[model samples]
Target: MEPKTISTARTARYISLGEPGADIQHVFFCLHGESQALADFAAQLVNFDTPERLLVLPEALSRYTMPAGPAGAPLTVASWFAADSLLPDLADLTAYLDELAAEVLAHCPAGVPVTVLGYGSGAAAACRWLAGGRTHYDRLLLYAPVFPPSIDRRATLVGLPDRPITLISTTTEAFTTEAVGAGLLQDLQDVGLSAQHRYVSEGPLTLAALGTVGK
Candidate 1:
């Protein structure tokens, strides 16, 4: 199958991975962190080893550069939602996700298990996607996510009933010292979501652990 492309004037990009004709029983859609591109975690799929059978989709957003970076340095970055600067809104992201879901459905057969994985701000985007009701996924993996102040955790919890979610954080001393991370874990659990929090010594999200959950 030929590779398909999606582009916008804002500079967002999405790419599909794995064998085209293989039996695709699982699908993984990853949302990248702040100031980071999809390329950062694209290679990490090898650690999962399930990419060959799972259709992986990575999406990039359009963002502006910060003048504070350096003297007159123009930086271009991707973001799912606006942070400090005025960029894309949640509606833009929701539309993109709708298109993405349609594309994934068109590429694969029915009854395929789908997983949505988000890191940092991507986590926020994933949560918003789940709240929007555009698509239904089997699992949601969050890696050191930073929640936005505007999001109402209670309101977002309405339609998501007992969805399986995994929260993976760094085990480094620095992260442990910050109680905020632990607080987020508690908050997620308090909302009646089937959530798991794991401290990773050092490694990206892997499929080995996720596969066990799927089974």
Candidate 2:
């Protein structure tokens, strides 16, 4: 049988860390990795919370229950996209994120700096959204980023050259290594894109550690 595709809608949730109003000075769009809940990811970034900056955490649409511990409750988490549903999920995510960002930006004043941060598997999602979505960010920060093969490098070259892209690594990165980080930076630099690699200690990746990027 031939495959068929259809579109549908469902209610999704995202976490906003700070108020969205005239007092807001910066906006941070953070994407979480696979098997991670939005609330859990928000906690990792709670230290970055400030009165002037807004942190928007968009939860992935695809969710599943994880194997619970013998005495623990059932755990649920989300992934931005699965390998089998890559294309369709990408389309849905792009639309969802675009709408969410637009709504947040609408509440803020003009010319507020927008920063996009992606952690682990979320790095590619941030790249995909920025490549195709309508929301424009001033800088990009990837923490132990895992860039998928499906990412559009050409689009990255075109869209990201003028903007800064920082590939953040640590002494104990679980997925990405120092060599991998260096190579990714080299590739971006080869294409004349302003990319850099930075190293941090083994700890929670925070905005304070990544001082003055794209400033």
Best by lDDT: 2
Q: Write the per-residue lDDT of candidate 1 for residues 1-215, one digit (tens) a residue.
A: 86454545454477567644337777777787777645556665556545445545556556656454456545545766655432236667777787877676666767677788877777877787777757878888877777666666455655464678888777665333322257667677677665777666545556545545544
Please report how far candidate 2 places residue 38 from its true position, in Å: 1.5
The model with the greatest TM-score is 2
| Residue lDDT tens for model 2, 16-87 | 998799998889999998788787788778767889889999888998898988998777898888776788
Off by over 4 Å in 1: 1-11, 19-22, 49-51, 64-76, 83-88, 173-180, 209-211
Q: What would the C-alpha RMSD of candidate 2 be, to one decimal place?
A: 2.3
Provide the clash count, candidate 1: 0
What are the runs in model 2 whose C-alpha is more than 4 Å off?
150-161, 178-180, 213-215
Tell me which residue pairs clash in candidate 2: none
Q: What is the lDDT of residue 210 in candidate 1?
A: 53
